[model samples]
Target: MRRLDPRPCVVAVAVLAAIAALTGCAPDAQPGPGPAASETVASPTDAATPSSPTPTPSPTEPALDPDGSAEDNLPLFTEVVEKVWKTDDRVKGRAYIDALVRAGFDKASMEVTKDRSSVGIPADSIQFSVRWTDACLVGQVGPSTKKPAAVVLPHLPTGGCLVGETRPIDW
Candidate 1:
């Protein structure tokens, strides 16, 4: 009869013991009950059932167009400014403020800059704005302002069209 080596048996036992220790499994460990059968696990199909629905805009809030373009609303803003534009060769910030106010924009939420540079020299451009929600409808008009444009932009937190200074609308 052949005798098995005790050293091989000892090494095998040591290797199994090391593996058991690393895996945190013991001979006396008990298995616990898992998830209930009634519980439905979420899958890719469940994504259709959103946890929360998209909020509906209030009556007073302007809704984004179904086409998903803010440009659809651009006409509403432009009309307000263009209706007040003068046919004469010159453009003024005051006219923009008056026109926007007449068109239902809040006067207190409007900003305009004098037709002059920061150094008090005559500027070729003048800017005006109407604060709308988180944005500003800005209008630029002057010889150098390049063909009179109106653009919508995020308003500064301090609340104005430009950084550091605006002319008071005395009228």
Candidate 2:
């Protein structure tokens, strides 16, 4: 009686199991609701049954725009801009800002400038100035030696902002 080589068989079974898992056909696979099933709702009770409070909107959903005013949107814009300026130097993950600018927020613009006593990544101390307009932005950034560093963001028709003036701008 010859002993069978178990290694190749074991490897083949492992590969098959991995493939099944990746294809989502494992024994543990469970069915999820279809679109029609998801749309189904339970019947509402009469007025005698108190209604449950409405749930808060999810982050993925846009907030209700009361009166649909541009100024109302400004707070959301300012909050995002300030957060990006204070935390990010490279300005990563600012897709929403780009969208806002591209959306022709000619009435929405921002300027940011940084000032520090010493030149370094983590400066000795820093200060920043900002100004925003409907069509343009002016601001400065720096260690404030002879001149402070500045950045200007201009509105774009294609829906994005531009940065300009590495040297301190007149504002």
Candidate 3:
């Protein structure tokens, strides 16, 4: 495969570790002026209104490395995936795949499961991945998944990351 330019951004090799830290862990730098905190509370007796912390103007995140191994990119990868999980489109595989593309990952290196099963039923969950050299940057999400998950796993013996057949990223 042709090498994509390495961009600084952001993995978990352990599946469980991926979902453990999903919320409010987005890149410290966000576009425009937006609330940095997801929620705020104030003491009823306090005279001052609650204020959210100002987000850093620059990315406090590790840069994503296209030329690096999955482990080297997990931090920014987790952050990007988590950011997508916090959105309304959290359950859609396309959202995560698209977000990764926008974050500088090569779309050609990615794979994702179908949104629905062959029998026309919505899948319990979906898995997506990017083959990064010897490791795979993988992620899962859906109603059944309960939360977005990610990991870096060694390529399967069959030379792919996921075990089952995956959908095409034709779009």
lDDT by residue (22-51, candidate 2, tens digit) is 888555456775458558555466554557
Alpha-carbon shift of residue 164 in model 3 (angstroms): 0.6
**For candidate 2, what is the lDDT?**
0.41
lDDT of 1 by residue, 1-171 (tens): 998779988999999999989788554466777569998777886877778888977765333333433244456557755665555534667777876676666788778888778787776777888666656777778878556778888878776666656888777
Query: Over 4 Å off in model 3, which ranges?
Result: 1-59
Judged by lDDT, which candidate is best? 3
Ten residues in sequence with the least summed lDDT for candidate 3: 7-16
Question: Of models 2 and 3, which has the larger TM-score?
Answer: 3
**lDDT, candidates in the order shown:** 0.70, 0.41, 0.83
How far off is residue 130 in model 1, in Å? 0.8
Ranked by TM-score, the better of candidates 1 and 2 is: 1
